[model samples]
Target: MQPPDLLFLGFFAFCAGLIDSVVGGGGLIQIPALFNALPNALPATIFGTNKIAAISGTLSAAWSYVRRVKLPWALIIPAMLAAFVMSFTGAAIVSLIPKSIMQPVVFVLLIVMAIYTFHKKEFGLLHTHLVVGRREKLLGVLSGGAIGLYDGVFGPGTGSFLIFLFIRLFSFDFLHASAASKLVNVATNAAALLYFVPTGHVLWQIALIMAVCNIMGSLTGTRLALKHGAGFVRVLFLVLLIGLIGKMGWGMLR
Candidate 1:
């Protein structure tokens, strides 16, 4: 790739990281940019590169959130572990099945999520902590495993889905949901990377540059989300969900 192309991708990564750190859906930006930037690369290679870049930003955001936000470790830890394991299974499955088949399903889900979130004006506004004891842990495990699998097979809106599930199932505010989502996201990304890196699918050179840009964006986003709180994150989440819906719908149509 030329220097100009690299710059363009870096810029997109920055934007993706910023939005992803706030409420997920960064892949809605970064993945398309990667496909456009490196048309010759194999799809798996592009996906792998994306994972490497994304994981860096995710880790940074996770750390930033953990420092400031009160994470429910009992729920988060189990979820992270489940996601880590299931992500590998999802990656393995992806090697056999084409991801195109999943796009329509995901597109439909995004629409439903957007509608639900929009209609519920008070959703994700304040932390409710409805789940407690074994039920909470069970829900966390189930959500993490399912979403983590999705991330490995067809990433795109993994973060958004995670945040939404956290809010819906656990009644976490957007900020706490986002923070917990990042932890699980890091696990899923890392799990995917374990497969991709060994299979020679990642372009380390480009991924390194994108990682730096992604982290920079993550830092800025983390600060903003922390400063503004869940209300800010909720608004951004809705906007990004709209963009995700459009992107997926367009991809399916085309």
Candidate 2:
């Protein structure tokens, strides 16, 4: 790619990382930007490159959250492991299914999620540990496995979905949910990369540059979210959810 293309993609990656660190829809920005920047590349290669760039920002955000936020590790750890394993399985089978069918389903889900969150009003404002012990662990596993599969197959709003699920299932506020979501996202991304890298689908040169920019953005976003707290993250989540709805709806229509 040319210098201008690289610069443009890097800027998008930065923005994606920033938004993703706060609310989990970074792919909404980064993936489309990759398609626009490298129009001639193979689709799988572009996806692989996107994953390479995304994981860096995700890990950075995860580290920052872990240091600052008191995450529910007992629940999150099991979920992360489940997500890692299921993501590999999902990636392996991604080429078998037609994405056209999945797009509409995901679009509908996003719409429902947005509406439910908006209607609830105080949904993610305060942390409430509703489930605990074995039930909590089960919920974590189920969420991680299912969402991880989706991420590996068609990964636009994996982070957002994870955050919503964490909040809905575990009664976590937006801030803690986002922090936990980052850890699971890292696992899923790494799992997908395991398949992509062995298949020679990534463009490491571009991915490395994007990763640096992504990390910078992730750090900035992490700090902001930590400072502002859950109410801020909740509002950001709704905004990103709307953006995701528009993007997915347009794709389905097209």
**Most accurate candidate by TM-score:** 2
Per-residue lDDT, model 1, residue 109, is: 95
Q: Write the per-residue lDDT of candidate 2 for residues 1-254, one digit (tens) a residue.
A: 89999999999999999999999888878988999998899988988999899999999999999998887788998999999999999888988979988998988899999999999999989998654699899989999999989988888889999999988988899999999999999999999888889999999999999999999999999999999999999899999989988977776677
Off by over 4 Å in 1: 95-101, 129-131
Query: 251 in model 1: Cα distance from truth in Å?
Result: 1.8
State the lDDT of candidate 1 residue by residue for 1-254, as single tens digits.
79999999999999989988999888778988999999899988998999899999999999999998887899999999999999999988886767767888888899999999999999999898554689999999999999988987778889999999999988899999999999999999989889889999999999999999999999999999999999999999999999988877777778
lDDT of each: 0.91, 0.92
Looking at model 1, residue 149 earns an lDDT score of 88
State the lDDT at 107 in candidate 1. Answer: 86
Where is the poorest 10-residue window by lDDT in model 1?
92-101
